[model samples]
Each structure stands twice: as C-alpha cells, then as structure tokens.
Target: MRQYFPSNLKHLCSHYRSISDVCNRLKIHRGQFNRYLAGTSFPTSFNQKRICDFFGVEAHEIALPTDQFLQLISSRTPRPTLAMITAPQRAVEHLRQCSSSRLQDLVGHYHEYAYSISHQGRILCSLVSVKELDGHIVYERVEPSASRSNGSDRTSCYRYEGVAYYLGDRLFLIDYESLATSEINQTILIPSFKTRNARLNGLKMGVTACDHRVPVCSRVVWSSLGTKACGPEAFRKVREYRDDDQELDSDLKARLAKAQIIDGLFRII
Candidate 1:
C-alpha cells in the first residue's frame, strides 16, 4: 500500500537546518528523503521507526494534526538550539543550565520512602543522594529490604546510579541495576520544595513479588532524609516500615499510603 508523509512529519523534517544532514543521519537516500519531504510517499515501517527515533518523536506523531504534533514534540523534545551544541565555553554553560534546572537546585540526601513490592501497605526505607558536579547531575540510591514472602528469609540490597534532571514540572531519575538485571527504573519525583515531607515519589516499571512478576503499578514514595553531608552513622536509619510499626510516624504513614506531603517528623527545604 502506498502512503505519504503527513503534513506534520514534513514540517518536522523541514524544521531541521539541513535536509542532507537529516538524510545522512537517517541513512535514507537523498532522493528518498526528498520524496518524503515533499510528502509524496512514506518510508517503510522500519524506516518510519528510524525517522521517528532520529527525531525523538513517537511513530503516531506522523498522523497527528500539525498543532498537536507541535505541542507534543515541543514538550518532550524541546528544539535543540545552536546554543546547546556550540563549541565555546559560554555555549557549554548554556547547555548545563538545562540539566541543572530549578528542581535540581535541591541536590542532597533524602530518606527515600519506596513502596514495597512484596507486601501490601508497607514501605521500604532507604537513602539516596542527588548531586551535580562539574555540570553533570547524577544520583545514587541504596535500597535495603527483606523478602519474607513464602515463609522465606533472605535479605537483599538494590543499588542504582543514574542521571537526574527536571523535565516539565517533575524531576526524573533514570537508573539501571548494574550488578543485577538490566531493568531500567524510571523514578518520577513530584516535589513540593518547601513542603514539610517533600520527596521524590517513585514507580518501578514492573512489579515482582519475589519470583512472581506482573505488569502492575507498584506504589512508591520518597521523603527527604536531609541535605546534611552524611557519614557511616547516617546509614543506620534505613529500615522496612510496615503499616503498624509504632516507630512509623502517623504523618509519614499517611504520606506513604495516601501520598500526602506533610511537615511533621521530617521536613525538606
């Protein structure tokens, strides 16, 4: 079946500074690229995916109205200005500004309150640090939890390292398990910067209750541990918080179960 590059796709290709450059990157023949640019015909499914990936756009974007496509792409893939790829030191500073967005301005330690995947109404407590050094923003996380499911007793620790940045209104940390599975964790932290218990809420891509795995949404939340520099002494506070523990502050429990940010036992500023 013959198809054509929709108006939106053509517009997206036009926005690029050079058609030849786009063709070279996409590895599409110059004639073929021009055909698509003219909206005379579309590429094969594989080529469509390549083109969309090259543009950092969704495949469905080809069918979207120009305005909607523009809006969607604008938010997800902000136009890379010449300022970002410039060779001079000032240009480098301009690029750094995006990674060091307003949210990343709060870089330090936090009492990560991740919702447990194995048990219901329980929380996993850990320590995480977000730091920006030499214009590179990065985060380190350490989660310690015990699996008591199936009457088994085994303890495990999950450590992750990844890049942290703010996109739109939320802060995101994209990390992978280095020593273990290559599973990618997309953690979205909704910050109420001055709110008492402000922390990054989390979501693991897949829910695995001990060997049993399912594609379900597991609840996760984060609470700021504090911004103070830490040492070996600070590591003692992490624990598994079940709903009934007396040590678990009521406000914190509410925040974990109900996703509320309050200022009681812990506060972030």
Candidate 2:
C-alpha cells in the first residue's frame, strides 16, 4: 500500500510544476514529502488525509495498486463515458461534434490584435494557434506580460487555452487564463466572407489584469499567419504596439481604433 501510495502521489504531482511547488502549495515539509515520494517513509494518518484532500483523491484511492490507480484516474479524463456526463456536458459535446467539420479549415496560426486591456491607446498583438485535437477544436492564445521592462528582465507570458466553435455564421471562443486560473474571456467574431486577405473581425470581453480587474470589451482583429507561423520568430513579435509603430499595417491600425458606441452597440465596422 505504501509503495502504491508513492506511485499514485507521483502521478498526481505530474499535473503541477514541481515537487517544491506542490510542497509550498500544500504547506507540507519538503524533507518529509520527499521521503514519501521515495517510499522510504509514509505520511501519518493526518498528513495522509491532508495529501489526499489536496490532490482531490480519497485516502483509499491513493493506496490502491498502481495499475488500478492509473486506470481509475484515467476514467476522469476528457473523454468521459457518455453515461457519466450530465445533460449540459452532453449538449456541449454534441455541439463540438457537430461543429468539428466547420473548424477544419480554420486550423492554423494567427496574429491576434486587439486594444490593450491594460494599456490605453495601444494595440496588443498576440499569437494564436488553433488546432483539432481528439475530434475537438481547441486554441491557445499567448500574450506577453505588460510589465516586461525593455526586454531586460525575462518576459513571462500569459497563455489562454480555449475551445473554438463556429455556430450560425459566427465564430465563438471561450477561454480561461491558464497560468493564474483567475479569469475567463469570451470572443465572438464574424467569419471571413472575402476570398483574399481575410481578417476575422470580432469583439473580445475580458477583465483587466490590474488590481481592480475591471471588465472590458474591445474590438479584436485576427489576421491569419497560416499554419507554419507559430514558432519562435512569431512569438517574439507578440506584445503591445504603439499606434504609430511602422511595422503595423495602416489598415490594421485603423481597424483596431477605438470606435464609438452607436445606439448602445459597440460596432466593429
């Protein structure tokens, strides 16, 4: 049971950054935790309960044979059995299945441009990659931290992972902040109608990263970079751009301008 516990604990910790990170978050002593991982010792009943609670597992479940434990946890993966899903989950899964074909053509990378949620009057350009995984359409949007000091200090990135669905002539995206897990954002875009140089115009709603976390809505433009443009060179280009930046296309700059609210509707046109 103790041997099984160590393997189960290791599996649970794989989802997190590192053992030290887990120890810090769990408020467990590093040396004692290492002993448990090494199978040289086991936690007391109280400490075992704490570990089980932190990992969202029952005490008995963690002590199961390692093979049985892995199988038990694998059942909770994204591809849950239809019988285990609730009505709402079933409906969402149905929608994803129905819309899978429509998203096949949109599986590529793009440069996402929108008004800076943190910095007024500047446009924030981020890298977005959309792909089909396990019969579902998913996307990842990466934005460089606003506090990057002239590239002197390391630039940490904010990543948002979301699902994409094309429904009723509109493209819809809903994502949460993957790093901090503090916020969710939604974007609705009009699908491209033109054959050449198509840009998806949309509106994004998200809260600012500031202390106040004020909710904001801004016009967003996504320009396709094709499938091969999401590597290092593209990521380096992700950051807020001044209105007068020479590299920004004049048309794109105009499209991202602050438009007036007309009759209670914030129009992107």
Clashing pairs in 1: 110-225, 111-225
TM-score for all models, in order of appearance:
0.54, 0.66
CA deviation > 4 Å runs, candidate 1: 1-23, 26-100, 147-156, 193-205, 259-269
* Cα-based lDDT at residue 104, candidate 1: 57
Error of 2 at 222 (Å): 0.6
**Model 2 worst lDDT window (10 residues):** 76-85
Please write out the lDDT profile of model 1 over residues 1-269, one tens digit for every residue: 12334567667767677878778767789898788767777788899887776666667766676777677767784654332343574444444576435855657787766566666666667777888776667788876756522223554667888776666666767786667764667776666757643655545444564666654444456666577787775565566766687866776666555433356422222
Question: Candidate 1 at residue 209, lDDT?
Answer: 41
Best by TM-score: 2
Model 2, global lDDT:
0.83
